[model samples]
Target: MSSLLVTGGAGFIGSNFVRHVLATTDHNVTVLDAITYAGNAASLDGLPEDRFRLVVGSVCDADLVNDLVADHDVTVHFAAESHNDNSLNDPSPFIQTNLVGTYELLQAVRRHDKRYHHISTDEVYSDLELDDPAKFTENTPYNPSSPYSSTKAGSDLLVRAWVRSFGVQATISNCSNNYGPYQHVEKFIPRQITGLIDGVRPKLYGAGENVRDWIHVDDHNSAVLRIIDDGVIGETYLIGADGEMNNKSVIELILELMDQPTDAYDHVNDRPGHDMRYAIDATRLRTELGWTPTYRDFRSGLAATIDWYRANEDWWRPMKAATEAKYAKTGQ
Candidate 1:
């Protein structure tokens, strides 16, 4: 069994991945998280004590990172300042965590000759026009539009350089949008879900025509595991399930599913530099690694997600007010 270190393991996707690994594999996991506003330690609760541990620290701490790297057999780097709105308001934290933090992880892995996998987003490729039929692939050129995406692009470049110049055993995966349990309320899906729960109207951005290629968190984690097992070093893979939907449609559906009127939501000003659409082509990962996503039906997966949030009110209630307040300030 491998000793795995998952940075940001308490956050949305990382926590889901940690649970996935524990449930499906024999590997023992060490979670290194900074416990930031987005990182919820409670998500990792009830994990098997002997097989899991949490280390509260920053990935930018070189000494701490080196120590952790030396102890683990593989590192899946997931820590980052992921919220686009927050990044637009203040880009400094994004620079520190996404760029400098990644460099530190790369250095530690290189020094120990350990395997590394960098978790990134499709936003690094920028947005496609609404009418464009093309999707992001492994060969897509880098053209990030926001500070958040730009820093992620920088991190991906760092991993590539480390693989080439230092011969570090590393792979990269740029995944499309993820939606599932443990997601912070500030995200699009959970924001609306919690808004409905709190008797507040769901807020949409502008016309809400922007589209996102959705993938279940579990499916994304499964792809990551497949890559670690069979993917070639230095190769980059794109993970997606081809579940695309526009924001307005998604909000209306949520209202319908929650037994509310379809037109119950309100539209607000859009964020600056909002991408028009993001789609992922996972052809390479599918044909090469033989990985298939289990959550194919977007509505079904979304229904399960809605149930999760409904049943876990205590888990999300603390963050609801602040998240909505922040959005209210921007009129979004």
Candidate 2:
């Protein structure tokens, strides 16, 4: 069995991945997390202590990274400053974590000759027009629109360069929007879900026409495991489940499911540089790696997510007030 180091393992997607690995494989996992506002230690609670350990630290720490890299057989790099709104307010942290942090991870993996996989987002390809039928593929050109996306794009390029020049055994995957349990309230889905829980109107941005290709966090993690096992090095895969929905429709569905009025939500000013749409084409990953997403029904997945938030008030209550307060300043 492989020993794995998972950076950002306490955050939303990372924590889900860690659980997936433990449940499905015999790999012993080491989680390296900075416990940023988005990183919740409680997410890792009840995990098997003998096979799982959480290291509280930044990915930008080269010495720490090197030490960890030497012990693990593989490194799954997931640490990043990932919120678009936060990046717009201040780009410095995104630059440090997404760019510099990735560089340090690359160097450490290169030093140890360990296999590596880089987790990234579809935002790196920028956005598509609402009427456009095209979706992001492995060959999409880079055209990031926000500081957050730009830094992620930069990190992807860094991995590519390391694979070619330094011969670092690495692969990259750019996934579409993810929604599931343990997500921070700052994200779109969880933000709206929690707002409704607090008796606040769910807020929509612009005309609420922006589209996102939704994928369950479990599906994304499953694909990551497939790649780790069988995917060729130096290749890029796009992970998606073909679940696409517009903002307004999603809010309406949530309200309907929650037994609130369909029009119970509010329209707020959209964030600056908000992308119009993001869709992913995962044909390559499917045909090559034989990976298929289990959560295909968007409404079912979303309903389950809402139920999770409804039942787990204590897990998200501490961050609710501050997240809403930050959004209040911008009237979003």
Candidate with best lDDT:
1
Per-prediction backbone clash count: 0, 0
Off by over 4 Å in 2: none
Clashes of 1: 0
State the C-alpha lDDT per candidate. Answer: 0.96, 0.95
Model 1: runs farther than 4 Å from truth? none
State candidate 1's TM-score.
Answer: 0.99
- 1-332, model 2: which lDDT tens digit per residue? 89999999999999999999999999999999999999999999999999999999999999999999999999999899999999999999999999999999999999989999999999999999999999999999999999999999999999999999999999999999999999999998999898898888898998999999999999999999999999899999999999989999999999999899999988888889999999999999999999999998999999999999999999999999998888788877
Model 1: per-residue lDDT, tens digit, 168-199?
A: 99999999999999999999999999889889
| Candidate 2 residue pairs in clash (backbone atoms < 3 Å) | none
TM-score, per-candidate, Cα-based: 0.99, 0.99
